[model samples]
Target: MEVLLAVDVRNELRRIGWISLQPNGSVSVGLNDRTFVSPDFKAKNFVWNAYNRVTIQYLISSDPKALKPIKNPHLTFHPPIKFQLRANGQHMLFEGIADLNIMLQQDGRVPWIRFVSKPVSELSKAGPSWNPDRTKILSIRLGNEDCSIGLGVDFVRKDVDVPTEDLLLSEFIDWQDYKLYVHSVAIPAQIATLSWYHQK
Candidate 1:
């Protein structure tokens, strides 16, 4: 399993010359070059209907989608392939979201969605007390009863549509260890273990 990174982003479309204050004191807004259209009514012949006299100002806006969209190369996600993590013993189910990344593999032009095997990099405000880790570390150590993990995963489904793709999220369970940056945490001479295996 591979750990992938996902970041949320938004693109701003509103710009200068797109909005202006008319001499009549009305706020005129529109897509600089696009014609305005809207779902509203109302017309009264001010010249003929003296009873309907009233003042009105207009502030036009467009639907979010109607505004031109910007492409984001960083976003390669599409309909998520399904995945489930089940731990050994008592059949406890581990749940997670696998922010799927749709990619074209070298094996063929066919698209594939990669599963996240670890918690996504931080931006989390849930605080340290919130344990959303979905990795095998915890699942593989339930009260010292001896453990292993079973994972079920599937590839991109044929009928999946791009308009409303199902997204997934993966969690962090445990790590044999994590690397330290800025400085070395250990050296070969200070090692205690001789071989690598899942942490006990």
Candidate 2:
């Protein structure tokens, strides 16, 4: 049986912009643009008069057909793909909005969704935590029963999207072993098309 990352990301699309938080994570989505079309109250007065107005936002996911293994020409490291997620709030909000809410009303479910995997270079190392640039190590463990696996993220597109990856050990190990495991398969990008409330 394959164990996949299971968690729901709830987003609050408010007047100013969209706000969301993962089940138990601090990383949240914020605006990366301001091209969103504002509601035209004069032309369609009833639309804005309604309570709990539904403003649509675009969600981008990887094209299942786009899934391809990360072929490295240098072959320095071939880490297993780790499941990860990311987003640029500004880009998604504008694109989804300009699409006339088509992407947000997907089968009455999520609008646009994609799935893609990440490269293995993101896996955590087993040796001492020392950065050439002297960046302090955040967490030394994967926050699981065994500390072999570690969770790391990839900033595929700084403002447009984010990819989340997870590291996993191939073999089970005791905590004392302190060995690193092979990263799990990376989860393709998923569009999080969401409806929000516009603050006017």
Candidate 3:
């Protein structure tokens, strides 16, 4: 599917407290390292654009749905984005903004925006040919300008010891920091399971 990502510059300016564009108002969105035709090559690298704006495009075999709706939408991504799809031909993972829903108040101050991810069970059931390990899905939260809150899920492959990685809307997470901010959350196996257990 062809997707157009339109960002509200006005609101983002207030949140980050600066304009992303250069004095000439040019920004380049990088699509490096993010280009993934083969899943085995997961290169976590990106180039920066001095320009204030940028655009990126990529092709993927699968696209996941939003597991949850975003409540606050005052966030945007830094340019030169590389979108990569994991080796699983069935799953496509990108390193761009996980949450883009933002609202601008009349006063000009940018409020907290909300970002959400789709539940693993929903995505697995929605598309049968594409069986994704939803436990692999992660929700990462950014606070202030430096600190980050990582939320990990217990869903894992019993067979493979795939190292746990950090998920972010930004370009990439540093290898060292991944050890600190990462934490796990429970990913329900299925909606039916929740209903069945609640009844008891």
Candidate 4:
């Protein structure tokens, strides 16, 4: 899955820009002639709204047939693309928005991509408990069992007894990066493992 990043100002289509991913893994984004500077002007406060909205589009495939209509051909990013945003001069890391996922179509032809705007109370409901410093396990009660899984952690807990049958490890590889996800929730205790995984 590839992602393309674009942003538009409130109530104006004329004021729009894109974040381009360079071959060396650096990014170039600009609004008109003003280019975005990292660790300085970070992208932050992303919520879904009509004004000043950021659109994250997914490029399903690179085949010419998949590039249908050819509108704005530059909108796309290879999977595992990671970066940080400065929201209003404050350094807002990408992990701050880990809870959000791109909303995709159900037809299965294309995957979902997310659009973000300013934070609102209603939007918080859909967001995850984001903590860049700590990993969280979202729990649910299934009968008498405590079913919970860790997010933002790189390794499985050492003390927990994860059922071999229930454990799932999956990986997503792209041109620039690779990611791994482990699903093992049948364990009974809270476990702490390594932090996030990033491989070039």
Question: Whose TM-score is greatest here?
Answer: 4
- For model 1, how does the per-residue alpha-carbon lDDT over 1-200 read when each residue is reduced to its tens digit? 11212222131111111112223322211111121123332222213222332323222222343333211101111123222212122121222222223221211112211111111121121112122342111111112212111111122323332222222222321211111010001111210111101100
Compose the digit string of candidate 3's lDDT tens values, residues 1-200. Answer: 11111111222211111112223322212110111133342222244323332333332211224232211111123322222323223343334331111111111111111111233212211111122332122222322222212122111222223344443422211121121112322332321110000000
**TM-score of each prediction:** 0.14, 0.19, 0.17, 0.21
Clashes of each: 12, 36, 23, 13
lDDT, candidates in the order shown = 0.19, 0.22, 0.22, 0.25
Model 3: CA > 4 A from native: 1-83, 89-180, 191-200
lDDT comparing candidate 2 with the true structure: 0.22
Superior candidate under TM-score, 3 versus 4: 4
Judge candidate 1 at residue 109 and give its lDDT.
19
TM-score, candidate number 4: 0.21
| Candidate 2 C-alpha error for residue 14, in Å | 30
**Which prediction has the highest lDDT against the true structure?**
4
Which residue runs does candidate 1 get wrong by more than 4 Å?
Answer: 1-11, 14-17, 22-26, 33-200
- Determine the backbone clash count of candidate 1: 12
lDDT by residue (84-114, candidate 4, tens digit) is 4322333332321221112111111121221
